[model samples]
Target chain A: MNLEGLRVMGIDPGLTRCGLSVVQAGRGRAVLPVAVGVVRTPSGDDLALRLLRLSRAVGEWMDEYRPDVVAVERVFERGNVSTVMHTAHAVGVLILAAAERGVPVHMYTPSEVKKAVSGNGRADKKQMTAMITRILGLSEPPKPADAADALALAVCHCWRAPMLFRQRAGLIDGRVSAAKRRTPSPDNHDRSFPS
Target chain B: MNLEGLRVMGIDPGLTRCGLSVVQAGRGRAVLPVAVGVVRTPSGDDLALRLLRLSRAVGEWMDEYRPDVVAVERVFERGNVSTVMHTAHAVGVLILAAAERGVPVHMYTPSEVKKAVSGNGRADKKQMTAMITRILGLSEPPKPADAADALALAVCHCWRAPMLFRQRAGLIDGRVSAAKRRTPSPDNHDRSFPS
Candidate 1:
């Protein structure tokens, strides 16, 4: 069995609304919402401090759960430039938290995750929440959109990318190697010149 | 032999100075300084376009290098409030580009790179350049402050975290078993949680 007992830390990283969900992978995986909330940097509040708080929260999750895999939603299609930029900074802090631990990080596109959660690739957020609740057998909706997105990433990894079942879950290339193979290829992980 | 002569793309991500470096990781491990330049947003230029340009340039690098790993410099300390916030956004864009292609990203802190390159935990720029030049066996100093930082990260990984080198580097949480324990612990990726 590839995933005998794998716990996945799924993150919907956002500047204002960041949702963190932890799920245990078994024959049938169940997403237990370990932590979920927002980091609202009100006017005059320091953005850097907000980011610092987010990173630390994620790190704490790392220490507590000791997850085998971390699935973060790729920030690809945000329309606003500065907001997109802020989202990017949040991601930097998030990725930094993961990378510092020497843990490999994998990013899933919004569409890919939506498809995993909703069956239809273009399903709306309403559908996503409905599907997520059904798949995980949840009592209520995952709450905010980011929370749904967080669960989507976990479900995506559980259903779409199963090898995350492995302990390391070394990055799926995050580009060509990951895109091309869509599964593990021979050259999936080349650590010759690491970061 | 596992590396398959992969090319590693090194990026020193910044708001004013984002430097891109390409190093081919093969049997001989050739570290070639292909391109080094900065994208100045020109004070009032469209931040989006500037980012789009940065995105395009990064895309071009991805096309040119076809890097197996996108090594990024993890943000360590940002003294300026607004400056640090903007820098975070800039890095967010960079991660998006790599994430789009599924480009595996790795990050190292300023201190980690400094210690790796110069044998001193608190080495400054001049000391860093001297060590970087020596390690890459370069005759001339790499231009632009951030470019040197970028190249240094790539070389830092090459010299310090060699793939075949079987030695744990950092000194924390070694108790977890890699044999059955997968610890996705990151360094300098400090953040505070609700705990």
Candidate 2:
């Protein structure tokens, strides 16, 4: 699978501030950042209105950028139930916007994203930001932690999507692919998917 | 402030099975059931696909019924974190669908629905189901719990929406309105605005 010229939008879903990043990547070439921004919704508004704002913003981004694929941060176990619910709600809107535009959606867990960008599953926020800055050749890490996480997610997808397609196509054995061989030996995002 | 003849679609958001019910209500008539059904999404499918299915279904219902307003059951604090997340995600999709069509969306809590329908804030499922069957003049309660809950939510909105409008219009004072005077003196759904 030649993944070159593939455009992907990575979304870190949050009700207050959702991070969105677009990256272009393929094999044997440096990934490039196309766009990075955050969609902010006022916490004082009604819940439905807050979600509607997110949905519209995501839809606008998809229409303007027209990415081939969308990668969203998978919501995982968290201490704040309200935060988890809000994140999941935002994620659904993101996925719906992409799906409505006939784009494929993939979810990557935080651990997988951290490991892919920083080579450590338990990497802290600062470590993840530093790695994303270096990976994208940016002068500095993106603003508001969420933006950096979104870029990391986009990069992770670019690095991992090809192997997933190959696995699905039965072109490679279930053990490992050439791309995995070149990358760090850590837990992969596409592995044990649909979490 | 005349909320009569308002058609409303009530939604009970769930990933596996989303219950949607439509009801017609006016100032001086019995609240009538317009439609009742459930939209089921296989748990085996991708999360995005499931939500897209739900989004499409809700969109279709909005187009066919053209409800003036949409009422969604607000997801509340629950022991099961995953369930709460899924419910909130589904609720987001429901609200987005309605909002896209220029429909007003409102949220009602479970206790409010129970009190509005059964005059008991802590009404059990069976008791609520019995009340719904009696109120809707149906032979029996709608099957699959979710469907019945959806109908209950719709009825709850029909009874509560009028007072909300009156309050917003300043036609009613701070004291409980005449409509609420007839019902239980428990907490009202619209009193707090949003949970």
Candidate 3:
């Protein structure tokens, strides 16, 4: 299928709830929900394993849905440094999920998604929900509707520039194998994914 | 729970078959299987996400079973660097699972576990399995016996002291936390765990 019609998985990573939504990517905005839910990690597990589990949970979604694109929430203004660190760790879990699949990911800020859906950069959850319901032609809002917001983000991203996301992430199959070969591995921190 | 009375989750980390076993701690030896099996990460997902999925799979195991401790296979070989790296990564996922639950971990080298299980330090898989059967008083061997071996390693680590292992790693938890705080996040790495 072409970029405009590919499957998209939208995600909103959070501490208590990691929101997730999968939607069909047809041109007529015929979005269908493939899956939606949250993965819960108890307070007892370490942060690392929790993040790992979060990523894995999403991977299971990928396996079942086989989405061609992943659109995730960009870093919002975390209230505390500690919270930011936690959110960043969660973001890591997310990026790893898509990066490993060799699937192209398009990141959208909460503001951008808000603007796209509600025509305001600072749309409230209610507004976003209302707009999402209106746009998707649904009676009730999506389940765990926060997850639906993530799906909306993914749909928005694909709508923004489907082909551009793929090209930047280098998902063209060995298009940058040589470049990836030079990407450092092991205890080193520097990474060289094709952008 | 006291270390001696707690149930332990033993992990044998690998790319494809991550051996999972559970053992109970007691005066003499009372390790038993709580749950044992493989949770496959379907292909086409990202590598990091696979690790995340591994963590989640093992996390589910821990949640369902509530093991008090986790025992992991330590890295000692040098020839297979890439495999070792991935093994370390995979182990990280499992370890993170244990950590999220605040479950203490006891890591042992393959040889050390082998030595503890068999009288010989360099015992092979068959020898290790035999010892495991004898110790557990089982007529038939555990199914998918890698799980059995993992339990044996956990049993050994729990029973044995680690004066030497401590001398080498020097308070693994404290050092790791300090190092993470000091170092900048790796560019491409998604730190799956939070401090």
Candidate 4:
């Protein structure tokens, strides 16, 4: 797989509803969505059963998609404690699935996901939906908010992959020059929804 | 493997410190301690890396011990949300490992463990330790509290397994006659430590 043209699977992890999306990204070109879906486990089920359901779903996706990289939303302590705990469990299962399959995994903070997709770190849900729909050339934002978040993460990972790849390869010197310090790139320009 | 003589692996799950104990129990005899240890992962490591460390450790135990059944303490809500989250993640990895290996898995609540080990459902740590040491014919209780909890769980499962097996096999009469209900067997009168 060319580092420039990578297949990425992004996950918005949760126990009740886990969002998963796969995208093919190429240099200087729009991304192509390969698949977008959510895995649902009933809330009343045992936690162990719920995790097992997620593990199987994730394992199946990995085997079928053969993604070069898998990205998951980092679990933060913003929501209800129970919700955060469940999300952490889901993320753990996803990470284990990817790790066992030998697929590289990355975690994107929620703010970073928003910034990558909408060009604003604090982009609201409406702005995020609009930008992702336009970016993916979808008729509308992906069904359900979680799917949109997952697609946004995939797009974000693709956009940032080169910098990450460079850093990982110990080639960051060429990418980070003295002049680029403390200056925001023009590529980060945010556009308003055409209202 | 004889059904009457079963080996069990009990886990007290935690991300940083997972306690493991193996015990063998046979009909009308004292439960024997097979092994006891803890899997430690550094808190400074990435969550995924920590989980991977646990997964490998659990896999190693499962292979080396080959217990007839693997039991894990059910994750319960308590002190800190973060602590519960980490424990849930640890338990999920363990359950997945056992499920993948075709090993039977059981979950015992903390109260049930204490009740089975000691007569009281809410036995304190000191009481539980004394009971387990006496029950297992050990000179002293297992160290580090976590190991004791694990051994308690394993012994509890063994003590309860016969009743569970009978219930599952439809051995007991449908009515559970008065003659079968009230008499405590002579073998169960282990009063060395007192009730």
lDDT of each: 0.65, 0.82, 0.65, 0.80
Interface RMSD for every prediction, one decimal?
12.4, 2.0, 9.1, 2.9
Best by lDDT: 2
Each model's fnat?
0.24, 0.65, 0.11, 0.32
Among all windows of ten consecutive residues in candidate 1 chain A, which has the lowest summed lDDT?
A186-195
Predicted candidate 1 versus true structure: per-residue lDDT over A1-53, tens digit per residue: 45646677788877677888777765534444454444444535445455556
Q: What is candidate 3's lDDT per residue for A89-194, written digit by digit as tens?
A: 5665565567667777667788877766566778788878776666566778876766777867865665556335544566566758456657763312111111
Say which docking band candidate 3 falls in: incorrect
User: Candidate 4 falls in which docking quality class?
Assistant: acceptable
Worst 10 residues of 3 chain B by lDDT: B186-195
Total clashing residue pairs per candidate? 15, 0, 15, 0
Tell me the tens digit of each residue's lDDT in model 2 across B1-195: 566788989998898999999998854535788899999999888777888999999899999999998988887657587666777778778888987888998888999998888778899999999888877789877898999999989988887876676667544464556665677745444332121
DockQ (Cα-based) for each candidate: 0.10, 0.54, 0.08, 0.31
TM-scores across all candidates? 0.47, 0.85, 0.46, 0.76
lDDT of 4 by residue, B159-190 (tens): 77765665555445656544445656432433
Leading candidate by DockQ: 2
Order of candidates by DockQ, top first?
A: 2, 4, 1, 3
TM-score of chain B of each: 0.76, 0.85, 0.73, 0.85
Candidates 1 and 3, the one with greater TM-score: 1
At residue B128, candidate 3 shows an lDDT of 75
DockQ for candidate 4 = 0.31
Off by over 4 Å in 2: A77-79, A166-195, B27-29, B77-81, B166-195
